[model samples]
Target: MSPPEHRIIAGIYHLSKDLGRHFSLTDINLQVTNGEFVFLVGPSGAGKSTLLRMMYMDDRPDSGQIVVGSFVSTRVTRRTIPGLRRKIGIVFQDFRLIEDRTVFENIALAMKVTGTPMSKIKQRATKILTHVGLYHKRHDFPKALSGGEQQRVAIARAVANRPAILLADEPTGNLDAVSTRNVLELLFKINAGGTAVLVATHDIEMVQSFGQRIIYLENGRIARDHEKIFVGDVRDRMDESRVSRRAEQLSEYDIRDEENE
Candidate 1:
């Protein structure tokens, strides 16, 4: 049997992106290992989308090395990029499914591009559609579905090839409360199946519930990286909700230290 692959699927070393005066990512370094579930959290415009884009090869970093599987983002040639992408899957907040295609066709096409056989494509499409609770609408066009349904199709298509790493940007941003829970649960199910999942989200309750490793960003830098601990929801009006409470606590500590000095 072939030996097990490296635990680290991707490694980012001193990665940075600058668009003239706008710096999206600054000296960001991290790693996504095998079967790990990580949340990329931050306030608006914290460069969360930019980071995921760089990971999936939508854009290259202005400076730094991103090693995904075997290809290095800084050095991956255009010709080799397509191959590099075959090992990674990506989903966006906006459902990018083809409006003209049926739900089954949307997912089937993703696998077809990878040269999956017609018979296997049919089987995989049915299985994934059922998994996402969309098999009943397999024949429906994306235009006929709601936002949540469309997003579900996008996710099914993204994972059609069973990639090693799944990058999701606000997967539940367009979903309703129930749909949000459904999608989040589906992501957890996928992660349980051994696909390393990295999600960038704002739903504090979901993060608090899972209590997974959270990578919080601020001003294009990883402000904090740690697990979340929910000490009961306060339902308060304070700006420092559960997500920012850690930062708030750190600020309090600093104040106490200054007073002691």
Candidate 2:
């Protein structure tokens, strides 16, 4: 075999977006060596998404050094976004699947848009769908599937291109306990196969259960970085009570509270 690939991503002095102001990612250096599974944890509105967005070129940093594999993302042009996107897979919590399309079609669409040949599309799509444990549901549409299944289809579509890096944002937010375990197991398998994985999530319990290396952000900067710590039994981090729902709704009012003061 040829020589092994070196580090997949490296960044130092990253300064990106903030809430209507500049944020300092300066002295914020990190390195993701090949085959590493890393977690990016933080509170909501703490720039976790913004940091991840910079990696995929959805948002550019004001000034920073970023290198992904061989591509210098901070210096790349807009024309290179498609190419970069093809090389990195992203799993979104909202499951950005097409409600109108079947699971197989949704996965196939990515390859097709990238100009993948028709002959190879079906083979690759089928393989990845099976990899994400959705081969049997290939004919089902997003609306027909459970929250977990829909997220699985999203994962399938993301990894269809066999990207070098996979970025997942709150992937297990809506999933049940069993589904969460399955999804995390699947991610572990992917990481074991030499893909660099980075996950941004608020599922503290799941993160604790899995015990992976974690980088936590607070108020737009890393607050505490910790090694994977297995502290307790697996637990559900979300609450489905009406009070929680009401509290979520109260965020709007809470914002008003800040304004009133």
TM-score of each: 0.83, 0.80
Number of the top-ranking candidate, with lDDT as the measure: 1
Deviation from native of the Cα of residue 225 in model 2, angstroms: 3.0
1-261: candidate 1 lDDT, tens digit per residue: 996574899788999887455757889999988877889998767778888888878788989989999989978888988887788888888878888899999999899888999999999999999999999999999999988788888888888899988999999887655456556667778887889889998654557545577898888898888853533222331233343454455568768889999
RMSD of each: 10.0, 7.2
lDDT of each: 0.81, 0.75
Off by over 4 Å in 1: 1-6, 19-21, 227-261
Off by over 4 Å in 2: 1-6, 10-12, 21-26, 227-261
Judge candidate 1 against the unseen true structure and give its global Cα lDDT, from 0 to 1: 0.81
Tens digits of per-residue lDDT for model 2, 120-198: 9999988888788889999999999998888888888888888888989888777755566667767777887778889
Q: In lDDT terms, how accurate is model 2?
A: 0.75
Worst 10 residues of 1 by lDDT: 232-241
